[model samples]
Target: MENPIINVKNVSFRYERENVLENIDLSIPKGSFLGLVGPNGSGKSTLLKLILGLLKPQKGRIELFGMPISKFREWDRIGFVSQKANSFNTGFPATVYEVVASGLTKKIGLFHFMDKKMKEDVISAIHSVGMDPFIHRNIGELSGGQQQRVFIARAIVSKPEILILDEPTVGVDVKNVQAFYEMLDKLNKQLGITLILVTHDIGTVTNKVTHVACLNKFLHFHGDKEEYEKLEEKDLSSFYQFDVKVLSHEHN
Candidate 1:
């Protein structure tokens, strides 16, 4: 991959005496939707933290947008929506527009007013996620899947080049899960945003993401979706070294 957007080279990390990651090397290209799948305690979250610049690797180097992560200060170019967003307080009195608009705090300043252009950006983001009708509704009143869309709108309101989601569909109903992924597909394909989704639903996400990467303190596989689809269930079982049978789902 020439000038990959995210580059992790010979990266290793540890917490106390427990080695969390070992000689991990991964590269993500721009405009590629990567499904990062792994079992619990497989260092999936840790790798995300490293990529987000929240944690530094103990060994090796990380570069974002071809710049060393340590020197990379374009934080706004990367947006992240955490799994905790699904657990937001239901009683919080914030409207969908208000919640999404908050994402511009860094750009607009905490106390600054949103100019006409900034407000349009917020509305555009909401519309992009198909949440225009619910723009004025209370976030807590929306369904789990709807709330996730609002959160995604907030993340993309900044017009980030890369959007990273950690277990985004945790609280969504099974019926709405597929629609949520379809929306993500639109974001990756139409909007041309690079996406790195950390998820446990290997079976479901593989259907949407362009690439697949399996991690278990080590990278067992990293390739296009077609290549990943070619792997046998037994191979995935060995990669996880735990329990993560990739069950096939019936999608419409």
Candidate 2:
């Protein structure tokens, strides 16, 4: 069998003087949607940054697409939708099309201009996230969920093979949260884009991701939903250091 799309070996990281991640090892198969879950202060975001090469690990190595992360020059292969990135003033006068078009900067490079095909691709990506109706609207003027969709469109505009999302549904309403996950499901299934999501939205994401990685300064547990079923509620509570109720309806 071939290696996974993403492979981390004995990785650890520190911030300033404190250790954030320790002895982490995992392999994420291609096209898998993974949910990284943990309580506050747990190195969830730090792990994502390490994978993105924003931060170098203090130990071990990370590989993407079967190559060292440092050697991967094709940045367009990975897309990122940061949490709270849409909270910036949508009222800043940039239209939705402009916002989405900005993501093509890497693919087109800095010196050249966006050609006709690139523009069409931007529009197509926006439509993929169901934000076509607001293509010309000022990004700041849209609601939270709409703004999130616009950011997602920006990510997809590059046609990335992998998508990394950090709390993509924050500040959205219940109905929109459902819509957001549905859109994610569509993107993963229809586009075959691998998704790695960092979120605290347990109930909503438990059933959505193909695999789950629970982290809190250390690897707590990671596997499919069935493996999670084998864990007792008390054990989970102990791992989290708080009361946790695994809802039957949601997990089922």
Candidate 3:
């Protein structure tokens, strides 16, 4: 009920030769979890990139916390975990502590050294994500699940109020995916951090996230879980053009 933390008004985006997203509008409240779902090439990642200010919108405006994203100065308040984190080489020669500490680079200001408080914050973040034992271990030595957690620690080290992730579960094992989602849910429910996740796991995410934003080259639907639940299989089949239903755990 608070003013929307993120607002997209008639926004549009396109690549070099094609229009990928059309006049899209969205509003996300603070302390909420929103899942963006759609088939491949649906502009889900593009939208997230726009929010992160990686790409400029072709038309319209995007506001964070009621101000134009361009004017917003609280970059540290938001955290981002991209799919690229999974591919980061473990042989990169960095410790988990160092990786997490990098998140405080911004807050430490330009050219400043890491202080005691920053180190403590990084350690706390690592512990929060259950990666304390591996804090001193080499990043490359960790498993895929452990690596993902380190990235999560990096994001949380900044103590961000909102966290956004793109395809976080991609390339991870089934058990690790569950662990990752559990961490996300904990951050949302216990820490009250608003979360926006762009993923293809509709069945799993739909049940966990507080809200849903379905996209397909445009904003198809953005509403609560109850609304998504009311949707019939036939309605979803039309969008997917095939049998569609939340995948059961048994199927996974």
Please report the candidate that would top lDDT against the real structure: 1
Strongest candidate by TM-score: 1
Summarize candidate 3's per-residue lDDT along 87-155 as a digit string, tens digits: 877678999998998888877876889878888888889988889899899988888878888888899
Reference-based TM-score, model 3:
0.93
Choose 1 or 2, whichever is better by TM-score.
1
Q: Which residue runs does candidate 3 get wrong by more than 4 Å? A: 109-111, 250-252
Q: What C-alpha lDDT do the candidate models reach, one value each? A: 0.92, 0.86, 0.85
Question: Against the correct fold, how does model 2 do in TM-score?
Answer: 0.93
Instruction: Report the number of backbone clashes for model 1.
Output: 0
- Model 1 sits at a Cα RMSD from the real structure of 1.1
Residue-level lDDT tens digits of model 2 in 156-249: 8989999999888787776667778878888999999999988787776666678888888888888876676678878777767888887632
Clashing pairs in 1: none
lDDT of 1 by residue, 37-145 (tens): 8889999999999998999999999999999999999999998988854678889899999999999999989888999999999999999999999999999899878
Candidate numbers sorted by TM-score from highest down: 1, 2, 3
- Sort the candidates on lDDT, descending order: 1, 2, 3
1 versus 2: better lDDT goes to = 1
